[model samples]
Target: MEPLMDRVLREWRGKRVAITIGSEHSFTGILEDFDGEVLLLRNVVDVVGNRGKAMIVALEDVSWIMLLE
Candidate 1:
């Protein structure tokens, strides 16, 4: 069977999501891509909900991700 992360990613691609990194940082954005090691997000917003540029997040630093849409 496909790995769980792969299945979730496939189903959630292009959707909005909220991701927590480490213990302090969080981001919300469109789930653009994930290549096993990193994630690409567009129209990103930071922890305080400040919308900014796209963000590239290293998978190792990700604590969890939640679908927002």
Candidate 2:
């Protein structure tokens, strides 16, 4: 079985994504890079050009990820 994140990384890399961690915090950013341990979210934005800093999230900490339009 393919890992879900792998599918996301292959199909959605460099695209905006929203990651909801543990049903608490929700992060929206461009899925720039990721590996075994951490996923890199770049050029994070909220409401059109918020352009917040990038965030590094541990793969273990991520609950699920969703693609954004």
Candidate 3:
């Protein structure tokens, strides 16, 4: 059986998503890839007005994920 997070990540994959890895950091981008232990996001734009072409996020570090319309 798949872990809940795996199922959730699979559903969020290939879609736009916003995530907070910690209280001090958050980002919005396309959910490009996830390999159970980590996730890769493309074209990441953050709430604090920062942007990047891509980012690799560890699942353990993810505080939450919000699906973006």
Candidate 4:
């Protein structure tokens, strides 16, 4: 099977996504870039709805990620 990160890179780049970190945080944005260890999201909004920023998230801290349709 293909690696999860590879699949994400292949299919999700430039798409809108929501990333959950642990049980307490959530961020939403466009998936600008990602590699083995981190993700770069543009046009980001944080858990409490703060907007218009870019966020870089560590892969190890991510609980889940979902496409925003």
Task: Please tell me which predicted candidate would have the highest TM-score against the true structure.
Answer: 1
What TM-score against the true fold does each predicted structure earn? 0.92, 0.77, 0.89, 0.87
Which pairs of residues have clashing backbones in candidate 1?
none
lDDT: the better of candidates 2 and 4: 4
Question: In candidate 1, which residue ranges exceed 4 Å CA deviation?
Answer: none
lDDT of residue 29 for candidate 2: 94
Kindly list the per-residue Cα lDDT of model 2 for residues 1-69, writing each as its tens digit. Answer: 989768768789888899876778787999988998989998776444466789898989999888886
RMSD of each: 1.0, 2.8, 1.1, 1.5
Off by over 4 Å in 2: 1-4, 45-51
lDDT of 4 by residue, 38-65 (tens): 9999999988889977888898999989
Name the lDDT of candidate 2: 0.82
lDDT of 3 by residue, 1-69 (tens): 988888888888899999998766899999999996888999999988898999998888999889996
Q: How do the residues 1-69 of candidate 1 rate in per-residue lDDT, one tens digit apiece?
A: 998998898889899999999968989999999988999999999988788779999989999999998
| Top model number, lDDT | 1
Model 2 TM-score, all chains together: 0.77
Relative to the unseen true structure, what is the Cα RMSD of model 4?
A: 1.5
Worst 10 residues of 1 by lDDT: 46-55
Q: What is the full ranking by lDDT, best candidate first?
A: 1, 3, 4, 2
For model 2, what is the alpha-carbon lDDT of residue 24?
83
User: Which should have the higher TM-score, number 2 or number 3?
Assistant: 3
